[model samples]
Target: IVLQNCMDTNEPDSDGLTPLMHAAAGGHEEVVGLLLSHGARLGDRDNRRRSVLHWAVLTYREAVLRLLLKHAATDDPLLIDAYDESGCSPLHAAIDSGFEIGVSILMEFGVNI
Candidate 1:
């Protein structure tokens, strides 16, 4: 597996997007799980300062959003409401993208409105 060979699971690409961010954005649940288990940093942000949660919501990846929420650390309250460079929170992204399920999931996870 690429993970087996790679040293840093949290390493970002030229665009500042980490593998976990990609998997979350693409709705690759299994890959996201694997990466997380392998020590991927959920807090890693893209060049635009979008968290993995943001990518999941922006891409309408509902299942990925749920998975991320389930794995997210409750201690980091800011994680749920992280703002991107454009000032879009995951909840805002979900509502703006018309991802009803995403909005519900984010609300269930306690995201601020």
Candidate 2:
């Protein structure tokens, strides 16, 4: 229905979270891919100014994080270092969340500590 209706993929909810943010938070890689293919903005921030990469790392969504990184690699390459309102970068969020794999992935993508 979303695809057929051509729904606004970048539309945020009351919390300022778009479908991409929710999908990344839930570790829904396929949904993230679908949304991205439909032009979902990877840099969209939530109410807290947390990007989809931040949400993916905070939630320990390894697959979603990878997918996001893959797209971001060619597009907005700086997204890996994006900071939220709290000044927490995706790398910071991943480390603080104790997600080793997520941290490793972020580092591999050239995200500085």
Candidate 3:
């Protein structure tokens, strides 16, 4: 129904979060796959310039992060290095949040330290 309605996949909510971001943050891998298949923009940023990858890492959504990385634009450095208003990269967020698995996953994906 969401795709049939042509809902703006890139549109942000009041919190500057798109559906992709929310799905990734919540570790909803199936939803992430569905959204990506429906042409959801991987490069969309929140008001803080944070991408869905940032949300995934911050929330320790390892599976979602892996799914996102697979579909993310290879040319877009922001997917790995996205910094929020506080200048925290996805890797930094993982490390700061004490999510060891998240940190390792980001590192495996070759995120800039």
Ranking by TM-score: 2, 1, 3
Q: Which regions in candidate 2 have their CA more than 4 angstroms from the true location?
A: none
TM-score of 3: 0.89
Candidate number with the higher lDDT (1 or 3): 1
Candidate 3 global lDDT: 0.82
Scanning candidate 3 in windows of ten residues, the lowest lDDT window is 70-79
**Tens-digit lDDT string for candidate 1 (1-113):** 65978778888999899999999988899999999888888888899999999899888888898888988855355789999999989888888989999989988988887
Scored by TM-score, the top model is: 2
Q: Give lDDT: candidate 1, residue 104.
A: 92
lDDT of 2 at 14: 99
Give TM-scores for every candidate, taking all chains together and pairing residue i with residue i.
0.93, 0.96, 0.89
lDDT of 2 by residue, 5-73 (tens): 988999999999999999889888898999999999998889999999989998999888998999999
- Runs in model 1 lying further than 4 Å from the true structure: none
lDDT score for residue 12 of model 3: 90
What is the Cα root-mean-square deviation between model 1 and the actual structure?
A: 1.3
